[model samples]
Target: MANKKSTKTPAKAKKSDKKPGLIARGKAYMASVRSEMKRVVWPTKNELVNYTVAVCASLIVVGVSIAVLDLVISEGLVLFASLRG
Candidate 1:
């Protein structure tokens, strides 16, 4: 069998072989992305509302917990600093 001669150089061969024009490929990619996005299972209005309220309540609880911890730590640091002075 005869050996096949490569027409492409090493650098050019390393790049993508299936390179299409930018605009055409971008439009095709966007069309595929839109179709895939349509397949997503979005939450209903009631479920969305419930999730929003749950997140807000958790945020408030965490905020208060952090504030209380900050106050306790600040007081302890101040007391220790005063004793050292």
Candidate 2:
């Protein structure tokens, strides 16, 4: 059989491959977040209100539709049970 090469690196090489400490990584992450936030285009007050209203209206319509469907299905099951009795 052919000889297998050693997978282990020297102690000095292992030290060079070590990653940044937790505190250094955390600081770098916060710096990136601050930089990205500066590039954001936040919505105006009027646009924010309009978006909120639209979302609320959609929720109300969906809720009503589901309530109606539930009522119909419940009534159907009741009628079927009465007929089976």
Candidate 3:
């Protein structure tokens, strides 16, 4: 008697190749964000205030310098144009 191979069909296995839907992706992204946030070492109150003041002072200095340069250049241009005319 010859041994024969079984011809029965195998059961279908579930496939996980599909991409996650929008809500699932959003939840995963938020979870990752929250996890990263937990690892942050935030600045203290004094450090925050010092940084704020430094930024404001730098801005004021830059603004004043730009304004003075603009005024000087404009006046010089007016004088040169008037002398030429």
Candidate 4:
């Protein structure tokens, strides 16, 4: 294998590859975030209320279903144990 010549020395390459300072990076990140936020389609108050209600209703239904199943299984196990005794 032939030795390849590098145009930029290690020190020069490291300097050129150096990242921006913390504050500069933070500012750039915040600017990008602000621009992205501007593009978001936010829900109206009425829509938010509707969505909240729907989510609550769904949780209640699933919660009740799980609770009922748990109760049935527990009671069945207790009955089976009593029968065994």
Estimate, for each residue in 24-69, the C-alpha lDDT of model 4 and write its tens digit. Answer: 9999999999999999999999999999999999999999999999
Q: Name model 1 segments beyond 4 Å from true.
A: 1-18, 83-85
lDDT of each: 0.93, 0.93, 0.95, 0.93
TM-score of each: 0.73, 0.78, 0.77, 0.78
Please state the error at residue 40 of candidate 4 in Å.
0.3
In candidate 2, what residue range of length 10 has the lowest lDDT sum?
Answer: 9-18
* Candidate 3, run of 10 with poorest lDDT: 9-18
Which candidate wins on lDDT?
Answer: 3
**Native-to-model Cα distance after best TM-score fit, residue 20 in candidate 1, in Å:** 0.9
lDDT (10s digit) by residue, model 1, range 17-82: 777899989999999999999999999999999999999999999999999999999989989889
Question: What tens-digit string does per-residue lDDT give for candidate 2 at 1-85?
Answer: 6999889885664457679999999999999999999999999999999999999999999999999999999989989888645
**lDDT, model 4, position 59:** 100
As for TM-score, the candidate ahead, 2 or 3, is 2
lDDT of 2 at 78: 89
lDDT score for candidate 3 against the true structure:
0.95
Which parts of model 3 have CA positions greater than 4 angstroms off? 1-15, 83-85
lDDT of 4 at 18: 77
Residue-level lDDT for 17 in candidate 4? 73
RMSD of each: 5.6, 4.7, 7.0, 4.3
